[model samples]
Target: MQLKQELIQQIQSIIATAKERAIRSVDTERVLMYWQIGQVIQEEEQQGKERAGYGEFLIKSLSETLQPQFGSGFSVRQLEMCRQFYRTFPNTNALRSQFSWTHYRTLIRIENQDKREFYIAEAAKNNWTARQLERQVNSQLFERLLLSNDVKEVLAVARDEKQPSDAKEIIKDPMVLEFLGLKREAAYYEKDLEAAIITHLQEFLLEIGNGFSFVARQKRIHIEGDEFSIDLVFYNRLLQCFVLFEIKTTKLTHQDIGQLQMYVNYYDRFEKQEFENPTIGILLCADKNDAVVKITLPENNKTIIASKYQLYLPTEQQLIDEVKKEIEKLDHDKMNE
Candidate 1:
């Protein structure tokens, strides 16, 4: 019986290893093929004999021939992608083996080279699947990073050589909770939003960005013979600190900030290990008064953060405008300094 169990376990391990290798081999081959296709397209374009229309004609002809012998992978659109795949990544040696064709297809859509490179490096380092990569790109991760950090820091982190060391680097403002399916106009309580977050914890964490891991929901803390229940608690591996979150369905007020500060103090005093950094608190509210938040928290405060939350995704124009406004504000502040 023991011998049979050992044999079965060995067979399973071998099969798993074989499957992993097969997938990697196929991915590498596909990437190389795209690189070669791109090289051919570039060479053809450089040849003055082909002219503009000739290149299109050549691709169409190639697709027509290959589609019959090959499979749907040889469709005209996919062939064009192969050409672009090469054009976008001119250096064949620079092509990362960590990414697949789908990853490249999503990346090529990004017009900004710097932004594209950032996404590529991040996706590779995080081992993001194609769908996750698409989400990050669509969510304007690069723009958000630019808003939160200096240009050099953003570039360094995006390139995966270094990570942001401050709380500001990982914290996002007006977190998009579209997955919650809550209507913007609907009147909801704080508990309602907390319930939705708990129900869709995995999706919420992904939308919350990197380094966050679920710790507890409705985490109970006792202080001075009184008990307090925090809405959600998380520990950021990157920051090496405990994160306490308080949910508010209405606009954040001084009371909201005060309550969260108390929570942060409690965690810092009682729960956090001496080796860990001070506990951080986040007030996830539906709305906020910027002036009030600024006055309520101390200047250069790092322990507590108050950010707005949106039940739905904002329009692309809105995101662009917001980023532009933030950049303008930074410029104004820098000029004053």
Candidate 2:
């Protein structure tokens, strides 16, 4: 019996090692291929005196010839991607050996270099699959970071080895709640939205951003015979903090902020460990007045955040304009300061 157990263990160990080695080998080979493809495209472009059209023509010709011999991957679009792949990562040695070609395909589509680099580092560090990377990108991860921080802080968080420390790092504003199937104009109570979120909790968490895990809903608290129930509670592994949320179907009031503050204080005093940071409170409301929130909270309040929730996805242009306006307002405030 002992001998059989040992043999089985040995086989398992061998299989694990073989799988690890195989993955590494595949990664290395793919990285090398990308580098070589980049090199070939760069050389051809230079030969043609760096004319843009020359590269396109070369890809067209190459695709026509190579597709028959190599099957599906040699399409003109892919060849163009190879050229872009080289342009994006001019340093072959800098290519992350951990990610596959599909990962690069997603990264190359991100036009912002800083955002692209951030995704690359994160994807490699987290060992994220191509699909995960796609989801993160589609969720506007870069824009969320930018909204929460300055350019320097955003870049540092993206590139540095340290985990993000701020509450805003984990909080996503205007969180996509499309999975709830709630109509924007439809009149619904807070309970309806809360129920929908609970039903589609996993998708909601992804929309909420990284490091969030649901803890409880309508968590009952009793203190001195007075009872209170929080709408939702979550723990963020990345921020190492407990996040408390309050849902509101109407425009947020100062009273709502005060109530959330009380919840935050209670959690900090009783629930949070000494090692963990103070609990964060978020008011997820249909509408919020930035001026009211600023006045209601302490001057240096980091634990409390107010976010507006939308039932439906806004048009891309509308989102862009809103972001632009916010940036302008921030800049104006900075100037006054």
lDDT of 1 by residue, 72-160 (tens): 88888888888888778888778888888888899988888888878887787778989888877776767766666776777686575
For every model shown, the clashing-pair count is 0, 0
Instruction: State the displacement of the C-alpha of residue 121, model 2, in Å, after optimal TM-score superposition.
Output: 2.4
TM match of model 2 to true structure: 0.84
lDDT of candidate 2?
0.82
Q: What TM-score do all the candidates reach, one by one?
A: 0.90, 0.84
Residue pairs that clash (backbone atoms under 3 angstroms), model 2:
none
Lowest lDDT sum, 10 consecutive residues, model 2, at: 310-319
Global lDDT of each model?
A: 0.83, 0.82
- List model 2 lDDT by residue over 247-272, tens digit each: 99999999999999999999998999
**Model 1 residue 265 distance off true place after TM-score fit, in angstroms:** 1.3
What stretches of model 1 exceed 4 Å from their correct place? 1-3, 183-185, 328-337
